[model samples]
Target: MATTALPAPKSGSAVTVRRILAIIGVGFLVFFAFIEIVPFVLTVANSFKCLPAVQAAPQAFIPLPPFGISCQTETGSVRSATEMTDGIAFNPTTEGYQEVLRQNLGKWFVNTAVFAIWVTVLRLLFDSLAGYALARIKFPGNRLLFFIMLGTMMIPGVVLLIPRFIILKQLGMLNTYQGFILTLAADAFGVFLMKQFFESIPGEIEEAAQVDGASRLTMFFRIVLPMATPALTALAIFSFQGTWNNFMDALIILGGNPDLFNLPLGLALLRGAYGDTLRWHTFLAGSVITTLPLAIIFFVFQRYFVEGVSYSGLKG
Candidate 1:
């Protein structure tokens, strides 16, 4: 007697497993997105709420009506609702923003901008020159000099704080914008980065230029630098960001002079003055303002950032 043929295993199981995995991946993405966005959302929400509402219901993103509802304080006493509106959940308030502006936030912004721009530009020029000389120019003890520069990179920046301060004081540069700008302009990393990029470029390009009667300066400016646009752009972005976000350097160098303060220093001062009573909305507003320029620069020159990372052998 012929046995009944067994049915083949269903192929649908494999497809079902893949679908489940895809769903799980999408779920993970959604979760991370929420995590990233929650702080900004909370900040925006709380910013609109009156001070009392924010303190009363710190976790409550939505503004609840005054309905005689009250919250207990540390003193175990119930306090009446002071300020809140039920119209919009998260409305924008210019109070915090206005305070920032009133306190010369514009000046801090300008200070940061000027420092970032000058440092970036000067670093590009000087670093490229030094890098080129080290990479191609044959001179006595060139290797030793390159090694010395590299060694400086290994030294912790914090360790140099006192020494740098002393030198600046000796030069009478403390509390001056020139001091801040010039110190950052002379960057070792920039030189090292440019040197690596220059090394990767074929020597044949420079040799050919020299063959055509181009002077060394002409070859560097016209031929080498032009081709190094990708590396240069990357360096510029890095230098700008470093100078803009720099806190300790600014604090140590600029001291207590609010007039010379950068955004970071100013924000720190705000936090110190406000402390626990600091308005979250104002803090967030200041954060938004401070972050805007870097965001713009990064987005605009994003291509260069990518090239710089990948081509310069620098990891994120």
Candidate 2:
């Protein structure tokens, strides 16, 4: 005799529930996207707007009219007309950007580039070396040293500004590139990140290299470093971003020297904050310029950045 067939499983409700959840999740994502991207879009838009337009309609995504229209006169002279229209016009101007460029932002860009590049390179080198030693080397006080370095991270960075200033003054490094470059060259977070990453790497790889008669330095530079690309990329991105956007330290150190000012200090100098009047247009233009490098760096190395964070925590 044949047995009765089992009832078919019903998945319609389950599928419907999943679809509902997916729609809700997608809605939340869209909301967050608007929240983050709208400001940048407005900034880019306003950076091309005239000062009057910016001040008149600061919160508007589109600049309100009375737009300036240039017409060639019969004698070959150009005259501007203010057009007030009902609909939104696409009459864009570059006054804010022109103001920023006229302020000699190129020199500030170069100074920022130099400061950020050197800080990132040196931090990566010094932090990676210290991290690798702490992770791989067998020595007395190694743990103590690591703990001391980690403990320093807990102290507020602002608290050290005065002390750092005094030391730089005593050393005659104030208002010098050395002061900014050396101040941020090595940091505790980088050391911690790299050490955790190095710890996650297996010891067998290093041992195998050693067995092949490779020296310690060779093993580290050639063998291990290649494997730590993700961590290094993350560290480089962080270091570059931190150094590039460092406003307070730049203010404290390079504030007195306009010739040595970076983008942050330059932007600060552009602000007109006497009794509530401000220059938002020029400030936003400078901000847009300053944000480009960080955006590029993050977009390029975002993959490694995620992986590095994952591996750093895996062993710790």
| Each prediction's TM-score versus the true structure | 0.80, 0.81
Q: lDDT by residue for model 1 over 44-127, one digit each (tens)?
A: 565544345554543446544443232344576533234343434332345557666887889999998998899989999999
Candidate 2 residue-wise lDDT, 188-224, digit = tens? 9899988988998889988988989999899889988
| C-alpha local distance difference test of each model | 0.77, 0.78
Candidate 1 deviant stretches above 4 angstroms: 1-26, 44-88, 310-316
Clashing pairs in 1: none
Clashing pairs in 2: none
